[model samples]
Target: MITVKAPGKLYIAGEYAVLEPGHPALVVALDRFITVSITETQDQGTINSRQYLETNFHWRRRGDQMIFDNRDNPYHYILEAIRVVEALALEMGHTLRVFDLDINSQLEDQGGRKYGLGSSAAVTVATVKALIEFYQLPLNRLDIFKLAAIAHFNVQGNGSLGDIAASVFGGWIAFSTFDKDWLRTVLKNNTFSEIIASDWPGLKIELLRVPSELELLIGWTGSPASTSHLVDRITIAKFAQKQQYQNFLESSRRCVETMIKGIKAAEVNVIKDGIRLNRQLIKQLGVFSQVDIETPELAELCQIAEDYGGAAKSSGAGGGDCGIVLTDHSVDQARLISAWNQHQITTLPLTVFELTGANV
Candidate 1:
């Protein structure tokens, strides 16, 4: 059996700003992961997930293509991932043999409530790794990330692919947007074989040192975020509001830069200031974009964390998902959690996941 596991990610800084080119987003890989297992099979290639009951899917080879019964499978990431790597194999003049695949995720509940921890990206990354192992492809971490991005980008049209990078190469890192326009053009214009063989010229992923004396406190808002819809709305708003949104993005860029430096240097005040400023800037984005970036509960949660002498902010796109608190000590961590509980926000069972291998 070929087994591969990839971690989920949380954005530490640089949210909406990373949508632009040449901007940095700091992301952390969490302990939770989407794991994929594959073994040689003779009859048919089947895909099953322990995380979703409705995701028992199977596929077969039809000439050179993989054919399936259901066209709109819920486990699209795995299917798309399989297709992507299959394209790579086909480009190399080989037919990928059949294998039975099983997927298991720690990122969501069985009832299908996403925790907003980049589950899709993790699934894509894990699937890519599993297929690579199955086929013995000579692909490195960056190759896996880029190929996984193809699968993810095929499914969701827009994203920085920062989450995918984090999952493929676990741990914290400073990431910039891959050339979305370039990738989109290739994905749209090129054949699957050409797309698989094409190089992603503008991809950027850099490693960052994790901060010291800080505890990562994560809390779930008890609701999921529609990141795709929110991203589409923001993209529309960026065009409509041009200069104003550009200013907001610039400010966000500065705040994220500060947070990265502070986290690296163990500068507590700089970290706190960056976190506080990010909250204000995200609110400004909400106003400029006319979208609810932060909910009342999240605002209250950040306030409670601030009151406890820690810094807090929403982790990702921020509609109704998890928020993070960077507290100085155990006392502050406990206080922030207790206070957030009072505000009806429950603390999530997550922490900063350290890498076992190379991060960069």
Candidate 2:
């Protein structure tokens, strides 16, 4: 039996601009993770697969013939990862036969929907790891990262590819400009290149489980915004010479650097100030508003958090998803819960994971 676990991630800075060539992004691997396990089937007659969030996949073996049971609209990203494994097995002249595969995922909630906190990337990483172990494939982290990128793009249509790299490498990462065509060519040649790591310091994150004890209150708006849509909008705005948009990107870069320092020093007040400033700057992009971050009900929750001397900002793709708050005063757990109830916003508690590289 082989089992693999991979971490999810959140973009700390340079969200929309990272898709462009020159801009870079800072992302962290979160505590939430996806796990996959694979084992050879003892029945020797059929292969069975069970996956959460979708129909079961089954296949029968008659002599050497393999018959697959199809799933309607199978999660495209997972299928893509399995395809990569199949290709590698074909190259090695080994046919994947009877097997039992199981997948389990734990993700944080953004509003009501599962706003992607790199869940696709985590699944891709876990799939690659499981395949490598089950098939005894001689592939490294870079190879797995590249394969996961292909799978992610197949599902997302267009993505930054930074999330896959962060998931595979773990910890914090700074990605330089990536040219997909160039990367594809390099992969064909079986050659790899080194990337420069920036000097941004790391932060000490404490994982908290008490939902009500959080000084910062997070809530979701009702609107669902697509990451790809936001990227396209930002790209068009950049082409049209929106100076304020350009300024927002530049300021965000600077803010990341400052935030890194604040985290290292454990200066909670400085971190709060940086988050507040960054939220105001992000609002300048015209993508979000105070109302968008919180509904009339959630607005009251924010007011309660603010009364406790905390600041709140949207998490993930924004629109109507999760919002993060920072506070300096003592947390009023009861009041916070009451406020969320009054606003009809479901609150999810999260703990930040310490940054670490992939386990070899």
Candidate 3:
């Protein structure tokens, strides 16, 4: 059997603004991961997972296309990964074979509740990694990232694709989005192979260095929010209030740039200040959009962390889900965790997933 793993991610700063091309966001890969394993099969192939209510999916091949026994399925990203990789394989004159794919995830609770840890993106990347390895394809991490991004874009159809980059290149990264319109034009004019090889305008991913004096903490508010739904709501508000939206974007850009500089220079104060400012900006955005980006639980999460001398804010789209905190080593982490526990907030024991030689 062939196995591959991709790590989950959390957004440190620049959430809604990063959707615009060239806007930057800071994201970090977590220790948690989604693992995909594959074994060759002669006839029908199966997919099994403990994460879903319907745990088994059977499929047969019709040429290069997969015909699943049940159309209503939860493997949209996984299936898309297989389709695109198979297309690439066939384009390279490689024959296809059947395989049983197994998925295991650590990005959720035992009840299968997601922690807003980028599970979909990790699974997609893991599936692409597994198939490329299974076929012995000559592709690097960047190639896998591009393939997974394409599949994810096809399904979600929005967002910065920063999570995909974090999963591909582990650890801290400053990510800038690509021009979605340009990508659409390229897809229309070129073949899949050519599209993969072409440059994506305005997209950039640079790894970051964390200061030794800094400590990161995560708190999950027992509620999960649909990122897509939140984004869609914010988009409607953006068009209605164009000037306010533009101002928000400009402010977010400056804040993220400041944070990046701090990380690069190992200046803990600058980084923490940037986080606090970003949190206020997001709260203002919620007010103007009339959408509660930061719920009551998330507000309490941030307030408690701040009381303990940490800079805290909602991560990602943040209707609910996880909130991140940045603090110096001198702060009382034990007290902060205790405070969170009293408020029914679960403190996740997640650390930064440093990129090693073994990670792709």
Candidate 4:
């Protein structure tokens, strides 16, 4: 059996601007993950499937049709992931038969759907890795990236791609599309290796999961916003010479630099300031209507977090989804949780984890 576990990601900086041609972004891999395990079946050439195993969830391929039991709607993400693997197998002129695949994902904080955490990208990464191992395909990280990109495009049209790259590579990365082809050149020329081999100290990161004593409240705006729609709107606005948007990007870039410095220096106050500044910059984008963030519920929650001495911001593509909040003080956490309870917002505990490559 081959198992692949891919971590989800959080964009610490360069959220929407990363999609621009010359902008760079930084991201961190979270402990939240999507894991896939696959093994060959006795019926080497035929496909059969099962769902929700007594011991573990099961999925089997029978001929061209893949079947599995539906335990939840979130499994739709898993189904989408399988489709990508199936397509890749066909491209390789090989068919996988009697394969038992199990998918397990952990991202409850987003209530199963969050933007900034890269849940889809994580699934894509794990699915691609499982397929590569199952077919014994001779593909490297770049090859996996290409496949994951295809899946991401299919799921979320014109995805930022930064999330997938972060999930696949892990650690803090300064990614730029400045030259468009620069990334490919760097990979081919071993630029990453050269940088790692140097004597420079690696970046420092703190993974703060929501403490059990505190509640990380997340409220969804009833309206579902398409990431593609927002991206298109921003693109058109940028093309039309929207000075505010440009200023937002520039400010975001500066915030990114400050964040890097804060992380390096281990200054909690600087980190807090950077978070607040970044939130203000995102608010300037004017993507959220009627609310400074996304949903009124989320905005209210942010207020509660702020009252508790924490900071809150929208997690992803922004029309509506989850909000991320960070707080370490216990008294503040108690007040935050009380506020969330009064408002009836769902809360979860989140922790920051070290960013590591997806090899398991």
Tens digits of per-residue lDDT for model 4, 12-106: 55668777655556566666777778877775532222221212233559999876533222344456656766655666677766677777767
Rank ordering of all candidates by lDDT, starting from the highest: 3, 1, 4, 2
| RMSD list, candidates in order | 5.7, 8.5, 5.2, 8.7
lDDT of candidates 1 onward, in order: 0.80, 0.58, 0.90, 0.59
Clashes of 3: 0
> What is the TM-score (0 to 1) of candidate 4?
0.67
Using TM-score as the measure, name the better of candidate 1 and candidate 3. 3
A best-first ranking of the candidates according to their TM-score comes to: 3, 1, 2, 4
Q: Candidate 2 residues 188-302, lDDT tens each?
A: 6641222111111121122212222324444544444455555555566666656766777788767755666665667666666666666666566654322232234334545
Where model 4 places Cα greater than 4 Å from the true spot, the runs are 41-100, 108-116, 137-143, 170-225, 287-293, 328-331, 355-359
TM-scores vs. true structure, each candidate: 0.89, 0.69, 0.94, 0.67
Residue-level error in angstroms, candidate 1, position 265: 2.6
- Which tens-of-lDDT digit does each residue in 1-360 have in candidate 3? 998899999999999999998789999999999999999999999988888553345577999999864322348888999998988888878999999999999988987778999988898899999999998888887888888888888777777899999999999999999998888787678777887888888889999988988988999998977777688899998999899999999999999999999999999999999999999989989999998999999999999999999999999999999999998986799999999999999999999998798665
Off by over 4 Å in 3: 54-74
Worst 10 residues of 3 by lDDT: 68-77
Q: Identify the candidate with maximal TM-score.
A: 3
Candidate 3's TM-score reads 0.94
Candidate 1 lDDT over 1-360, as tens digits, reads: 878788999987888888777778888899998888999999787888756674434477999998863422437778899999988877767767999989888987566777889988888898989988888877777778878988887887787889998897777788888678888788768876565556666567887776577677888887777776688889999999999898988888888888888878988778877888887888888888999989877777777877888788887888988888777764457666787878788787887677665532
